[model samples]
Target: MAPTESNKRLALAIIDFLGSSLKDGTLTADDAESIEIAQSCIADTFKVDPTDEAAVKEAVGGQSLASIYSVYEKLRSKSTPQAGSASTEQSQTDKPKTGAPTAESDKFKSEGNALMSRKDYNGAIAQYTKALEIAPGNPIYLSNRAAAFSASSQHEKAAEDAELAVSVDSKYSKAWSRLGLARFDMGDYHAAKEAYEKGIEAEGNGGSDAMKRGLETSSRKIEEASRGTEPPSEELDSAPGASRGGGGMPDLSALAGMLGGGGGGGGMPDLGSMMSNPMFANMAQNLMGNPDMLNNLMGNPRLRQMAENFGQGGGMPDMSSLMSDPNIADMARNMMGGGAGGAGGAGQGGQGGQGQ
Candidate 1:
């Protein structure tokens, strides 16, 4: 029999998951032979040759892969396909089904991500809700929605989505990172640490390094919390484009919105989108590697008050005014280019840390 619509979808979802995971170093195998079957099957199912990356991308609609096995595994666990009776097929063809969730859900997911990039988090959440209404337990939708919730500072809700993402696919490394981050932000340091540990083991250093750093941050947070002391100010939060993460350091993709930066167009800053720069990543790494470096850099009289302001959650200092002290400005410039702590690669997955 020709491939049915259901079979095509299954093949597509599997390809979306496997192709992306294998390419991104997230699912690296020591030997290529391991995934040869997966590669060949996806290509065969799509009627494309195994060697054509372009063809693979085209078939998957140029969308990034989330979890390959998430939906498929659920189908396996839940119910088996029932062969449609001739009468049922005729009736279905005669009367089109209404409100059946399908590719439209993917479009909703894309819309939600765009809103998230624009920092329209509430709007993003709404879009994600619509997607969920269609493909309820799809891990990709759950994880995307989870990211938006975390961005909006709703760690509890974010944790719920992230939790569901992992439950849908235990091998989903990104979901585990999301879970660790959400738990960290909720002040459940113990749980956060545990989750990160699992995430690190599953995804390895390449894709989920953020979970490892999160493990470290949680350990520190737990120690400090036990003593009834607030965690120290984060070095990463003090630099330009710097944002905060649970008081460890500021990761200001959000603050970047609040800060004054003008792109060619007059739109609200793309805080979330702008954070993809390596500069932000590098600054975070340096500070995390040598915690003392921040103390030394901020020792200058000019930065002391500004650092204090961030620590207190006072509205950010005026950039022009802060830069008026050229010495301070020079110091700030130097700091951004400062030592590498080898602390990069733990992207948004490490952003949650029980805000102080």
Candidate 2:
């Protein structure tokens, strides 16, 4: 008789089981190579391709072989009255009915952890499900399952589990990290960044290295998506402007904008707002403290012309001339880049200059 689809599916499942075992270190390297040879032979005999995920899914009804085996184990454990079943039943009766981490749940969680270590994501998920049955709202169980779900490429489920874990225990840093990773995988960079930020806040002591790295990556993604350019390395730091004091040069374009500096528009720019702006205030402070920068600005021909005209009582001399100066324009461009890069790093006291 010709090999049926059922026969091919069985072979595929066995192949998957062997691969999972190999990943979990249940099989030695030589055993794995032998198993690989056996798998090829099985594939040839059954005319089945284990790599055909669609066929495998269809054959197994969308569940991994490990998941199906887990179900079988549960059913078998219940049906077959083994010698240890009486003791197991007694232990279950002795545990509390409410709250998390019953003996049974812990056992399941340990199994899940083992499966996770072996890279058996579906198997781990099944074990975690069993754990969650005993302790539905347990953050650790939810978080572990979320990790398994993420490993298995079920990002939406991972996010859901991570969110539930955090909701149950807001202080859980791992849950928050998992949530950030899930959100990032979904391309929600803003949400990922917020999650990482919350995770850091929950951690209190500057957060874990993993959480910090996640935050930095998400921040970079946000900057790239919004600004269409690479973000400055310092901007990834928690406080962008804390180290770079107000000594940095001011945004020249902003100063010009405040003094009616752009093209065509003749009326004076909002000097009141300009005075209130953190960038302009920093610029004025820097110029006052750094005579060299001020001299450099004044030495530019266009700025010299404007200053000369203004000195002669020509009120509000055309700032276009000042802005058009190559030296001034170059300074403005550099300052503008810095301002934009650190805009999000502006502290409560407005230490960082706003992008013009």
| Clash count per candidate | 11, 0
* Residue-level lDDT tens digits of model 2 in 1-356: 98987888898888888887888898878797799998899889999998998787566654357756654454344334457655356665564443358888999999999999999999999999998777666789989999999999999999888877776666888999999999999999998998899899889999989999999999999988977665556543233222222545434554353344544244444555565777767666554443334334434455545645654556786558656644565545433443533322212112111211
Query: Where does candidate 2 stray beyond 4 Å?
Result: 1-99, 229-356
For residues 1-356, write the lDDT of model 1, one tens digit per residue: 77765555556556556655677787767635666677677758656453556654444433333532344455344333247844345554553232234678878988998998899999999998888765667778888889899999999999888877776666677887888889988989998887777677668655455767888999999888877775666554454423346755643333343333334124433544445667755654555554444444434444556645644666557889977764545444544763232122121112211111
On lDDT, the candidate that comes out on top is: 2
Model 1 TM-score, all chains together: 0.38
RMSD of 2: 19.2
What is the lDDT of every predicted structure here? 0.62, 0.70
**Maximum-TM-score candidate:** 2
